[model samples]
Target: MKHSEFDEEFDVIVIGVGAAGAAAALSAHERGASVLVVEKCPPKCAGGNTRVSGSGWFINSSPERAAVFLRALNGSRTVAEDVVQTWASETAKNSDWLADLGATARPTGAYHTEAEFSEVDGADCYAGMNTINGEMGQFLLYEFLVGALAERGIEIRFETRAQELTVVDGTVRGVRVEGPTGEATLGARGGVVLATGGFAANPEMVQDYLPLDEYVLWGSPHSTGDGHRMAQRVGADMWHMGNMMTITGIDVGDTTGLFLALWAGHDYMFIAPDGRRFTDETKGNRHGHVQRNGAEELFPLRPFHIVFDEKLRAAGPLSPTSAVLPVGWKLLMENFVWSTDNSVEVANGQIRRADTLRELAAAIGVDPDTLERSVHDYNAACDVGRDDHFGRDPETLAPVSEGPFYSLRVVPLLGWSDGGPRRDGHSRVLDTRGEVIEGLYAAGEASATYSWTKDGGFHIADALAFGRVSGAHAASRVAS
Candidate 1:
């Protein structure tokens, strides 16, 4: 908590190990620079939300389709033309970088614009998943890259906190770190790359940025805005403060699966607190849906409901990549912390698997007549090839008509911090004036204002590309 003075030197000092951190460390080290990774949390959980995400980063977005996505989501303000063009060109370069490393990145042939696991391509852009080896937001990669760095004798200090940046003159200097015994100053002789994650999970940060009263987090405990706070203390210019996360259907009051089931086959028809349908879910892509100002509609951020029968129940919950029967009962039970069976029960709040239509509707809190009418309309449409209400994926509409219906709650979760310090093509952090902050280089999520179409949907290739850029440029400035 207190700060004195000490100094440690390296070619680069990386603060986090999520996807960008992994790529940054590996790329920085590969170019023959001494690097040190400083982590403030458990090694297994160091990757943050990157571990739980779908892991595919968007690269080489088909321009026509990517443009469509940008327009549809009203995100023309979030990403600029030069940014997109620059990122698109570097797509394959990052792919090459990943392959040369010990990691595997297979083109998934699908572009994801939604939280759901499936991929879709439209006039807006090429969106889909890129398969990675680990679940920690490219967790397998952190394992590979971090281990590789250790092998090269790149020292990493765990349980180490970087509380201050040692800046001298207008140019950058090193940082002050606090460890178990005493404080030490770790200097980045060449450059200091701050990939220290974001503050999405921090209450004050979330409230300051997101403006949410009831909060549920999907990211790691370490993402308490260490990056934003540290940068802010030094008069760093911050932008896009009005933006909050574009989440799926997350139950603000519940905890389980860390809010991932928003699209995980829990398909529940969402209604506002007043209970009415909003949005045509099947009509547009997922990114488009998440970006919608649901508050402008009736629900003011409605929650989702999945009406199913014994058939779908037996069929099970779904995973996008895997073909196993999907974890049905497991999805149900695992929702509640105290449930002995781990199956979601009515007593556990919104999860309902009932024997009759009216009973299920009553338990779910919608007017029985409305639910029945909606179901009848849905079933009729299902028979005649229409969704009339929300236009859900036809393949998913199996008719909640079967006796003993079920409902599971789902919501959009803030997967990771998508907003950070703006950076140039070379990963240099820029102030609000668009001038480069000398000696302050950022990459990965820390410097993440870039060629993106929607929320949390950046291509993994971009992370690698920028990581390489930041490191390559940093290596040049360091003494040989």
Candidate 2:
């Protein structure tokens, strides 16, 4: 492609302005490559999932041990040994990289430090790094990256969405973008790095790729699988398409169509649509992983409902004023605050209420007799202070026999779907034949390293590590 064919040109073009994209742009610029970043959202909503995430990166003491841990976590769907080693080594430099970009690292709070899989090999190497001053789920870390990019005078075209790659003889050279000014072609002299997050917010893509029968997106609303589609159109091989990181929550359909917390009161119990208790209600799910048949698997998607009574309602709020991660369209972008005492939602008809358990069952469309029997059995167990069915903690065993029952429907809430074009250790997007597609790269959730199980801070750590890899490698490539 000739220079005249594009509206503008740069040595590198980075799509999506999250941790990965910002890292890529900064890395490329540091290497003397002129970089251009294009974000689909306007300046206010530009950070993607990184802004809403806990904003912590993994810090490992030993690369070799980290490799062992990663391999164990991957299980049968293993990443190549070389790629795993590269990831392990590269992640060790995360703190140094952040420091170089003028970021101060501090320990992530206890909330994020809880071990996800302590039994895995090399778990001893695990540590978490976050910005010195910032609240969890706030945009502080993302702000640091964006500030670094700005300090370098790197140009970011807010509201510019990359539609497709401009390919010449199987070599990607530019991006076709749609922006406020309408359609235009922007050339990349080095390479194009795709940092577009995941498909959690795209219902059609979620239905097509994930095995879940029902779910609600809890990631960035703009994460609609743009990078996946673009890469697939260019013949990039995909991986880990079925992998998902999920939490359980209720869909507050009014504000952002994102999720709200299920009942936080101790008196609540989760029941399937049939009104029977399922897993232990108070058990801490490891990103929605629960033990099934002595093996870990995703908490199955089902019509879940929290059955409680007036005792629970009077205890406090069913949902918090803010989301746990506080990312999605509602919390991060729209500033939609949840009710404090569950009164607002109940009055608004989002929560169903009734004068009796049978009436509550009817309101939520469950069999009244089945609900009554389940409650009776549950109350009997509660009275004895022993739950034989799911082994719920005796302290949390509260009877639901109080009058004026309530039921709120909930489902699996996806943090992000980890799947996209397959990329090698160098962050080069590969074709189906495992060969590099020249001038094409992917980083961040677009080509995440996690396949089966993800540890705390893995997503941001991977994004930062591979974002640099993509930028450095792309900068080395000769212009087509």
Candidate 3:
């Protein structure tokens, strides 16, 4: 499609209005550059996955400790050492930086301590984490950024979608955008920053990159790989195309609903369709792998059952205190109860109830005899205070030999995809041969800076760090 030129020109055009894009716009404006931020979603839903997230930021006491965590997360992957080092050092000072900007942040607890990292084999290290507390933390951060942009006279066009990056003689010129008016091209004198997030919402892109068939999105529905495709058209290189950060234990029926079953702290036993325990149920409710057959065929795991007894059910709800549901969603689901009490869900047919293990297996369409034997073996191990099957902690082990049993059918949930255009320390988009693409920059989930999932706060922290770097670099080019 042909594009008409927009009357106004900008020094930097930042795509998407999430955390990274907001940071980039603010950073560019702070450097005295004319900036325009284009967001596909409306103003109300402008924050994307960043707003809906837990609003945590990972910051280490020192760069040395952070480097250890970074190296551990990028095992066997060839991430640039300078990039990782920059992330480490900048992240160390992020909390102070945010505070200087009037953002409140307090240290909560590290997901992984230095001692814990040493004990777990091949475990991703998580250290020095903080959460933006209070109910308004998420909203406040975005609001502050928006206010900053307005104060600097940087324009943000809402409901405007960036379609393509316009390149003139191998140098990026600007972006083609579709908005309420029409298709128009906005020229950027400095550069364009892509921060459009990932492809979790795009089924075609997810199918091409991810092997799992059945999954639910735990992030913003607007993450449709718009930036990835736009950059690829201009010969940008991509990386970690198969990497995804996933969370499991989502009820198949509740996939579209706001509620999520973060069963990390629960004592439910996960049984495969063949009626045998497959994994440690107490292990963190993230990372599910699709098994490939000998013929190199890939398929999702069969629907599994989360079996719990009356005693464990009486302890508390299957949902954890850390479970993230939108505040508005809580009001909508107020009438609907999701607890391990089994009364409310059983009445709604969301949970199956049985008097015995064999009957429970039959109810879930699994082998009754095999399920019975598996339960017997599991109960025996529980009695001995040991989990030989999956090395589960004995504290979470509970016998499933009660009169009333409950089961919930669950599947994997895709939080977000973390594969996109590759970038360097300066957040400049690079080609396949590792050469920088002129006048093009990428940050946040749009660039594959994070090859593996680290912790809850790492993504947001990385986004802010590189977003500033890219914004500063773009502004410098314009000044020169």
Provide TM-scores for the models.
Answer: 0.77, 0.93, 0.88
RMSD of 2: 2.3
lDDT of 3 by residue, 1-480 (tens): 223454556899999877788788878877999889999988767776675665566656668767776776666765888888888887776667677666677655434223233333333334545655433233545666677677768788999999989897888879989999988888888899998988878889988998667776666767889999999999989998887765554553433323345343344677887888877666543333321222211122335777877766666655433333332112122323455554666767777888887788888999988888888888888899998877778888778787688787776556667788988888899999899998899988787466753554677788888888888899999999
Best by lDDT: 2
Residues 1-480, model 1: lDDT tens digits: 122333557877777766666666777787887788787766655665455444566644565555444433334355555555555555545545666765676544444443341233343344444555422232444566667666677766778888877777765567777777678887776677777776666778766665455545554556777877777665576654434443444453543233333243423344433334555443333431332444211112334565656555554332222221111111222323322232544455546767776787777777777777666776676677667666666776545566667766555454445566677766766776777777677766565553233433452455666777777777767745
Report the poorest 10 consecutive residues by lDDT, candidate 2. Answer: 254-263
Q: Evaluate residue 341 in candidate 3 and report its C-alpha lDDT on the 0 to 100 scale.
A: 53
TM-score of 2: 0.93
> Number of the top candidate by TM-score?
2
Off by over 4 Å in 1: 1-5, 57-75, 78-86, 108-138, 211-215, 240-268, 281-302, 318-350, 356-358, 387-398, 450-459
lDDT values of the candidates? 0.56, 0.83, 0.71
lDDT of 2 by residue, 1-480 (tens): 449889888899999999899999988988889899999999888888898777888778789889999998888989977679879999989888888777888775745564578898887778754543535666788888998898999999999889999998889999999999999999998999999998887888988998777776666778899999999999999999999887766677641344545445688788898878877877666655665557778764655898888888777665444445544555666676666677887898888889988888889888989988899989999999999998989998989888888888877777888889999989999999999999999999988998888788888899999999999888877433
- Using alpha carbons, what is the TM-score of model 1? 0.77
Model 3 lDDT on a 0 to 1 scale: 0.71
